[model samples]
Target: MSPATQAMQREDTQNPAMLWIANGQQLWHTAPKDSNGKSCAACHSDAKESMRSKAAGFPRFSAPAGKVITLSQQINQCRSNAQQAAALPQESAELLALEAYVALQSRGLPVSPSRDPQTRQAAARGQKLFTTRIGQLNLSCAQCHDNNAGKRLAGALIPQGHANAYPIYRLEWQGVGSLQRRLRNCMSGVRAEVPPYGAPDLVDLEAYLAQRAQGMPMETPGVRP
Candidate 1:
């Protein structure tokens, strides 16, 4: 990123994502319309205390869901099971805002996905997908993000493809977006079939990425160009 962009991200006042964060903070305390008069705050109280380091362990196995799930999925589960509310639509502004708020609580914490057997298996599948060639370009994720990182592609730098900074403000999108959205963008770039949001394969890929980025500090609500 350029120096100006970096400065914008570092300062909360200058960060556009902070708007979503602020909305999320409000949502945390306000009960959903379909809820039984319960908000996230009703159970967890202060997020600063309840949600610390929580984002590090996501894309993990969920006993209730019987599969590996992303932080967004878990949030929806909580809404359904605990609040008796409908799930938020994937990529919705409200959902993204909530995710950004939750992730902010874990900023600077290390990535620490669960070590359960199910999670491990999902990560393995993700690794295979990462290496497998696909689409019209017949390119794998490793080709650009691993084999040719720092090289120019379409006049932009090809980053190393870490998943630490997510729900980020992308200049390209002019808004904050999830890791899954970014994954879909890559799939499209390769002219591959883009999976629907919340697909198991995407969740598996996230599991692998969290493991790959283990020990790295989270930079939630990050800014990128």
Candidate 2:
């Protein structure tokens, strides 16, 4: 990481994304009225300790869901099942804020998933998707993100397209966004049919990314140019 980028992540005051973190903190304690006033805090106190490294092991298989799910999806399911609350709408500000908060807790942690056997099929599909060429441009993720990483495309430098740092604050977007948003943007860049948010392919790709980024530190709410 650049010195400037490292410094940016170190402080809350300089990071505008901290607003979402604060909102997430508030929501953490917001009593769930539907489930006898229970709340996240009531179950898990102080996310800093309770959720340490939790986001690193994501895209986990849930027998109940019958497929892999991301940390964001897991959060929504938890609210519905544990608190008897309606699930948060996908890509909603509240959901993003909450996701940012949880993912932040895993900062500097390694990407590690249980890799349940049930999820192998999805992961395999994701591997194929990452390497396959598609769309009008017929560009695969590896073409730029792997094959020519660190080289210039047009006027911009291409990184290895790791998902280690996500829910990032992009200078272009002028706000924080989840990794799926970034993936969708990349899909558009390749002129591929952008996957709808929460699509199985997106989830699978996320799983592949988690494995691809294994041992890399989680840098949630990251800043990007």
Candidate 3:
């Protein structure tokens, strides 16, 4: 399901993820192992001032990788090079909490997908993937998310394949990161052969999702079921 569908409207004062956000705030300011001994705050102090608005613009292309990358991947990369901390495993609590923290920083900002011509082409490629069926079940993403949106599958409402809030703490996965992980789950559920992470198709698909979510608020590391 899309995060939009997963999101339960609530008073900002009663947000459940607020505690995790506080944890993230502390982690950002607290120094890590002394090997480098530099906190994320040491270099980038004040997330609200330095990182808040920036969180709205992500899942963007990276010149170094020559492909678009998600926010968590970027954060792990920074932790490795900047803080000398080992890369947090995917779905790990550290990663999830951090993702939630960063996402919460941009709670009200609008999502901005890439607009470069290259981005459009990438999104087009993703659209093709969304509509194509390449596995034993012969079902496409459109089968459930697009065509069957709002329908129930195993008691859960199928939602539009929106990528507005990612790196979410899903009740299923119980961790946080890009929607690609969820995509892989959907492919497996449909008896499809899942591609390796960071594959070309997934990159294209990410581009496509970013475009689809254009102008929607980015809520990362969100909680969902």
Candidate 4:
């Protein structure tokens, strides 16, 4: 990141993403006005304690759903099955804030996704997606992240593209964003057909990212350029 970007990330006062965090904290405790009215706090009580290290293992298998689900998906599931509240849109601001807030609870912890048999297969599929060239540019994730990391592309340096520093405050984006959002951005960059928010490929790809970055510390609500 450039010097200005680095400085913005260092403190909440300089970080715009903190605005979302404040809203997320409120959502965590405010009960929805619905039939199964309940806030996340109603069940978990306190986030910092109950949610500790949970985000680090996310994008994991959901036996009930028969596939891996993201932290946002799991949160939505709770709203439906447990609280009977209307679900938030996949990439809505409210959802992002809530997701960021929850993810922040697991900050600094290592990502430790499950290594179940099904997950292994999914991870392999994700690897295929990462390596396979797509889009008009015909680029794969590996070409930039694996092959050309630490090099500049269109005036920006390409990092390893790991998912660890997610729910991040990107200077270019000017807001908090999740790993899935970043993937979509990459897809668009390649001129590839961007997948829908909860598409199977996206889910599988997220699982693979978490696995690839296994043991990397979570940098929830991280800042980036």
* Candidate with best TM-score: 1
Q: What is the C-alpha RMSD of each candidate to the true structure, in Å?
A: 0.7, 1.7, 3.2, 1.3
Question: Candidate 2: deviation at residue 90, Å?
Answer: 1.5
Top model number, lDDT:
1
Candidate 2, 1-225: lDDT as tens digits: 456766777676887788888888888888655665778888888999999998898888987777899888998888987777888888788788888898899998888855787566677778899999988999999898889998887887788988977777777888888889988988998788997989999998888888888899888878777
What TM value does model 1 have?
Answer: 0.98
Count clashes in each candidate, considering only residues at least 3 apart in sequence or on different chains: 0, 0, 2, 0
Q: For each candidate, what TM-score against the reference?
A: 0.98, 0.93, 0.83, 0.95
lDDT-best of 1 and 3: 1
Pairs clashing within candidate 4: none
Better lDDT candidate (1, 4): 1
Off by over 4 Å in 4: none
lDDT values of the candidates?
0.93, 0.84, 0.73, 0.87
Query: What residue runs in model 2 are displaced by over 4 Å at the alpha carbon?
Result: 1-3, 32-36
lDDT of 1 at 37: 87
Per-residue CA lDDT of model 4 for 84-142, tens digit only, reads: 89888988898999999988898789999877777777788999999999999999999
Off by over 4 Å in 1: none
Mind giving the per-residue lDDT tens digits that candidate 3 earns over 1-225? 454534532333443555566778888887666438888889888888878766666667666556666677777777887888888776566766677787777877898776656667788999899899867889998888888999898888787878777666565654444577888888888888889766778778877887777788766546667
The alpha-carbon lDDT assigned to residue 178 of candidate 1 equals 98
Flag the better candidate by TM-score, 2 or 3. 2
Candidate with the larger TM-score of 3 and 4 = 4
